[model samples]
Target: MVDQAELELFRDNVRRFLEEEAQPHYEQWEKDGIVPKSFYRKMGENGLLCVDQPEEYGGIGAPFEFSVVVLEEAARMGFMALASNLSVHSDIAAPYILHLGSEEQKQFYLPRMASGECIGAIGMTEPGAGSDLQGIRSRADADGQGGYVVNGGKTFITNGQNAGVVVAAIKTDPAAGAKGTTLFLLDTDQDGFSRGRNLEKIGQHAADTSELFFKDMKVGADKVLGRLGGGFGHLIDELPRERLVLAAMAVAHARGALERTVAYVQERKAFGQSIASFQNTRFTLARLKSDIEVHQAYVNECSGKYQRGEMDVPTAAMIKYATTELEGRVVDQCLQLFGGYGYMSEYPISRDFVDARIQRIYGGTSEIMLEVIARSVLGR
Candidate 1:
């Protein structure tokens, strides 16, 4: 267990860093379609990226809670783009390399990743496939020279524009179904790898989501992550933690939304009184606040299970599915209270409303999560 005071200090430090660095430039970054790479470097300098990684690889190896705090703090401040992008870099991508990569892969990647000298990404979603891993069509064929040539495309990839390293999933044997899947470590500097435009989104605009292509990209067999034909299992194995990370963010972000809405209602006037004095406004605030606090406890419990290695896929999915859906409702209701101003892009509630949307769709859709949960209860 981490010392409580030290964790509070860490949270304070993270908030100070984001206020000074990210908060000021976030609007410009949103307009630019991406956050600058220098900001990532600064995050690294402050030991804000991958806090759970080990010291030998440039991390403080702080407890998992520390990483959760970093993400939650960012989300609580309404910097969804920063929170979303950093979640990919620190929570999703870095862990794949840490847990599955070869010694050489770790040495070459984790240090730079920890230092924000290199950014990491995962390539999984294809044009045709969103939630189903078995539907992936990108492929890698053995070259008979102790290597393979990869050819495929990935869309909606987070951190795509600035990725120094990508953990790409491709089919080694398409006929074999999920059993044939393989994961390759793709170094973006390689000749055949190309990046498409930074795709625009409804929100989280500072995140550099993009479409990536690989054409005859040859890599040594050594680039294989975990083992040949292990991609699906590897992806599944990681989902619990991945979903947990998103769930945590959802809870924190919703809290932020509620915070904004409460302040807005208290100050904004209605029929000769503050909007918050209205019974309808009071009830809505009460309900949302109650829901968020209850959900926070649930998320905290799930996170503890994860830290103890006791969390299962279904339980993780439950938290993710529940909290993200709650986030959607919370933000939308909060926006409703803002009246026409909620529709404007200028208000933080508007951002919260839009940003809350993708939480359900990504990290496995609510439907997919339900199916996973169903399998546990109904027998697959």
Candidate 2:
């Protein structure tokens, strides 16, 4: 179970941090299409980069719930781009190193990541592949000197433009299908590695999503993460936690949008009376409130399971699908209550509407989630 008091303290800290550091400059960051690297360094200084990392790595090594607290608080502020960037680093990339990296790799990377000195990203999605890991076209061929020459391109990579290190998935054997897949710890400074323009996105405007190109990039044999053929298994093992993070963010986002809408309806007038006084508005809000509360309970339950190391892939998939869809519905409904104001970009609801669109797409799409759930249920 999550420590309520400790979680509250963490939430307060994140809220103040955002208010003082992030909220004021969010508009500029959105305009720039990326947050400044200095902002991540500041978060690192505050011990916010990876709260669950081991103490030696500069993290508090807190429970996963604490990480969830950070995600929730950040999402509530409409900072999904920033939140997503952090998630890709801490929630997605850190696990690969912590679970499979050698002592040398961990010693060199973990502390920097914990301190936000190096931004991290993962390259799994490609122009032709999203969730189908076997469809990856990137290849890393042995160079006969205990190294590999990597070649291929990836698209829709979060944090691609600013990443110092990337945990990239590639095919070591074209005929081995999923068994042939491998992962590598790639350095952006290496020759033949380059990033394309920061791809314009409809939502999460401040996040640096881009296309990554690797042309004959050379990687030391020591840079391979995990067993040569174990990338698929490693990804499967870590996916539940990733989905849990997304689900927690979705629940928190729904609550934030609902809260903002309630405050707006109570103040905005229509037909010579406050919108809140209307039966339709009240009913709509009541339904949404109930839904959000229910989803929050599920998210909390999943967090508990995650803390205990008992969370399963299917359950995580369920939560991710349900909560994200709920977030989408809640934001749309809340926007409706805003009338013309909702359509205005200056309004929080408009931003929320745009940001919530990708929840169903990334972190495993809704279709993929259903496929996993069905396999578990139908004994497929």
**Cα lDDT listed for each candidate:** 0.92, 0.90
In the order shown, the candidates' Cα RMSDs to the true structure are 0.9, 0.9
Give the residue spans of candidate 1 off by over 4 A.
none
- Give the per-residue lDDT of model 2 (tens digit) for 1-380: 56789889988998999889999999998889998989889989998888888887777898878777777887988888888888888888987788789989988898999898898999999988887767899999999999999999899999998899999999999899888999899999999999999999888989999999999999999999998988899888888889999998998888989989989999999889999999999999999999999999999898888878899999999999999999999999999999999999999999999999999999899999999999999989
What are the models' TM-scores?
Answer: 0.98, 0.98
Looking at model 1, residue 164 earns an lDDT score of 93
Error of 2 at 161 (Å): 0.9
lDDT score, candidate 2, position 303: 83
Estimate, for each residue in 132-244, the C-alpha lDDT of model 1 and write its tens digit. Answer: 77889999999999899999899999999999989989999998898899988899999899999999899999889999999999989988998799999999888888899
| lDDT, model 2 | 0.90
Decoy 1 TM-score against native: 0.98
Number of the top lDDT candidate: 1
